[model samples]
Target chain A: MKTDQEGAVRSDALLSSWKQTPTRQAIVDYVDRALQEGGAEYVPPSERVAVFDNDGTLWCEKPMPPELGFILQRLAEMAEQDPSLRTRQPWQAARDKDYAWLGDVITKHYHGDDSDVRVLMGGILQAFAGMSVDAYAEIADRFLRTTPHPTLGRQLWRCTYLPMVELLRYLEANGFTTYIASGGDRDFMRPVTEELYGIPAERIIGTTAGLRYQDDDTGGSVVYQAEMEVFDDGPTKPVRIWSRVGRRPVVAGGNSNGDIQMLRYAGQPSRPGLRLLVLHDDEEREFNYTAGAETSLEQARAQDWTVVSIKNDWATVFADEV
Target chain B: MKTDQEGAVRSDALLSSWKQTPTRQAIVDYVDRALQEGGAEYVPPSERVAVFDNDGTLWCEKPMPPELGFILQRLAEMAEQDPSLRTRQPWQAARDKDYAWLGDVITKHYHGDDSDVRVLMGGILQAFAGMSVDAYAEIADRFLRTTPHPTLGRQLWRCTYLPMVELLRYLEANGFTTYIASGGDRDFMRPVTEELYGIPAERIIGTTAGLRYQDDDTGGSVVYQAEMEVFDDGPTKPVRIWSRVGRRPVVAGGNSNGDIQMLRYAGQPSRPGLRLLVLHDDEEREFNYTAGAETSLEQARAQDWTVVSIKNDWATVFADEV
Candidate 1:
């Protein structure tokens, strides 16, 4: 329904934060083919699902994922209440500001070592054990808005990648339903996704803690329990994608080993799938490292998946930079 | 904003299946206020969520639920493969044409007696354990379209209440996101909801079987496991509503004891909420019984929830009949 002039204006707005590169052309071409009604690669609007990873692909995850920073405050408080907790890992790492041990948890996870990740998860689970969903949301919302990204110097939300956010807008405007399928807690990202990514709370498909609905004197409330339901990462990402959306995504974006399954699941030789693996190789503007993204990078080369170089594909790193 | 003439036309189109009764007036009043942009009862379109119980509330659930009938065929095959299984309760009940025993399971569940219901659950879980979700959906879609309701003399999809589908269409046209929160399996209802209720697969929140995303040589797929992650009934209805939708519904509809919590969850005292309880009291056109809805009817009276009488409020029962 768009005129050629109108379509060009729309394309310019979508491509504003990206340099003219094969990566942008590939993404736009895949989406355009999917939108071409009655064409070979055309998908129905109902099936035009697009999913993304939150921490690294959407924002900077250098010092730590923003969620770990939010829970680090909780860990510090827990260690204060019980001094014995100071001797344990994650809690000890938080208390002493041992950034290396904290960062190693993620790096170890990608390197097929989840021992430290499990220890960090143990502390994280007990941090918000019996809080109401609404109460936990308030804390997460405040932390996301008020605190700075550990090294980025911007408020946590403002550090989101400008090009990725524009792609979300572009896809949504073209009838693709976007979802955040992160290993981060669902309630943790839900309160701010609407403001940061233009994706609403319900569209968020992330790791979930167990919940219980109890009737109280003042109506009722659904509260979070201590149990972990689905840890949506690695092989589990595709599972959550299908479980939540009920369709295979035509497009998926991610940045590490945890994303390989989802990236592979997105595009097929027969189906119109655009798999974008964001490579954080820009040290000047943002943190640069491939410690956790080694396998993902290798697979991108072998599989011909689009590798979005932060230094090459994107002209602006953070939304605030634009 | 609609002109008065346009509004009148829309109202007439929405109300065609309903009779002019106090129940219709109650529903219309709640919706009109929700659509009133600056009114006290007005809700933002983002928060205008409406949830419904699919079995009895949206369609005829008498002569046992349609899902029970679908699974009975599965039970029959199981019984035939192992003749000893024929002696068991549900298998025996299904094989012997003992509809009373099949119906009593639901009646017993609503009456706070879950003995037979548990027996039925054991059979249902093992029925289609390791099939892919897409394969299960195909079976469900065929069964739903080809099978006739026991007494309704129409395809199972055609037996859905005309008035309820109109309500779903009307709500969607008014910018409300509608969902089906049922005790039925999520996959079973997902294949048919879009065609039957105008609701989508992603919008279905129901009892979930365990699933895994398995990668084969030809990419990967999500397959169903022989486990029920969340049996969405009773108090857990509100739990799934929060887990999937992440927002309290402003409007809800139901017909059984399983739906009581969700109906109560909708429409808080401060926020705008309208709860509708459909009472199946018509015998000549449709089967009538209060065995499963006793507490629901009592609570509807005590809690001041609107009770929609099938005999009085609806001008038509089925779309096929209309």
Candidate 2:
């Protein structure tokens, strides 16, 4: 973190991941004007909210999303206990190590198809049922920090996009409260958000497992019930954001159609809304696929939103590389 | 707000509401130790959470809760349009100005009787359904700011207990983020919390009307649906607290059986927990009835929690009285 003449903190080291392109300049420019005391783009410190999508926007989702990586291991163990579970899918797919079926479930969800997503949620609810929130959070924290990505040969947390990490720090330095609004499980993301992205547990807005509070001779604790209360994708994103933050985000970042509602809700015609749409077009540097991001990509182009080309904008894809 | 010799902030005027009793001393002692750097009770900035119940704890719930006041008015308006609605419960009670029936329903709910609570909820769901969040917030804000208390004759916001208002400011000066956790509707409480108390819209946790987000050529907006997703009371208060803050609160204040689980959830056995149970024993200055608070008073005696006597401890009841 470096300080400018105005004493506003700037992160030259953090910003090094992005190339000096127009896309990078636009991000800096929006934040710069927001900091101007009486400038037209100036937003009060309290109103500066930035929401980022987790799965494919801030981190890698190829081969599989990291949460799926965590969930699959749990599902496989559960299937091993009850072999009859192998007859149904996502349990069967997990037991067989079928990435294609798991990946398809996610893609189908982005395309507004929830049939496979429901099947996957059924396995998810069973995999973690009755586990205390603290216990599950501890296990997830350990998994994210220790377990290697399936194809990336790196720890799950290390797969986070270096450029977006810089943007979070920059926004935070500029007085914006950053939040993770994603389709991933809230508990799954919260345990690792601060370590991976500088966001705290309370700022994570995501789909959640049904929670039941229990009291006994001992103290009270919350447990995961075998129910997916809300999927928190598509239409549910805006509702979660408003309920959690009580303000519309001035900026939104996304890579999939699941974030369409959030991206659309970002800015008014007169207000400053900066949307960054990450395009995974670099096959060599990182996994590249547009299956889940097709509509997001098309809308980004049509609306003249910032289409961030991974191959063109980012000088380094991962912090480890930089 | 004032600063002490050590340059730490304090509020002499706010504290003037409370008499210099041991109960007030205990409140100050807990905050002092929490602010003492490197001391045993010192808490970091982020984890200092204080949850307060709204209706009875923070303000006067007498003559019925303020939200019930707002809902009753709406119910009466709706009944005028459809006379058939007068046949059923809550609407019938509201339409008739039968304060006896309305007050009995609240008291029965505290004794673990939710039958009447359900009827009241049915009225609440229909009263504000199909209204956009912004539209509903505006109406609630106006009602809370303008409506006079039925018996006290004070404006709704000024009905807040003066001593608790001081505690909110004192805690805020010392870096605690206060929240309102109640059985009242989240949207209904949010609009008036900041002006009435020092808390913000995001920090108000309560039962919610189901929310649906709509998008069109203009933009996206969220509307309240008629469904009551979860009645945020009793066992559910802890669930709502955990879901909202992702941490157990250090301090809690309440005045009824509805807040038992929340007060119980305040502090862990090993951690610092300060529970304040307000005893409404002052009929001269305020309403005096222990009907709904029967169990809370019993538990306060058994557990040795701070039993705040409005008649004995308060130097003043309302801020305007000063």
Error of 2 at B223 (Å): 0.5
Q: Could you give candidate 1's per-residue lDDT for residues A135-190 as a string of tens digits?
A: 99899999988887666677887889999999999888888899999988888999
TM-score of 2: 0.93
> Candidate 1: TM of chain A?
0.95
lDDT per residue for candidate 1 within B60-138, as digits (tens), equals 8877778888889888988989999899968888778788888778777888898987788878778887788879899
Compute the TM-score of each model's chain A versus the native chain A and list the values: 0.95, 0.94
For residue A201, model 2's alpha carbon misses the true position, in angstroms, by 1.1
- Best candidate according to DockQ: 1
RMSD of 1: 2.6
**DockQ, all candidates in order:** 0.65, 0.62
The deviation in Å at residue B94 for candidate 1 is 3.5
Residue B7 deviation, candidate 2, in Å?
A: 11
**lDDT for each residue of candidate 2 in A1-322, tens digit (9 for 90 to 100):** 2223241337454477889899988887777777777767777787899998998899998878889989999999888999899888888999999988987887777777889988899889988899988899999998888888777777777899988998898888878899999999999998888878989888898989999888753347888999987788887998999888887788999988888888888876656888999999999888778888888888888877898889999998987732
Docking class of 2: medium
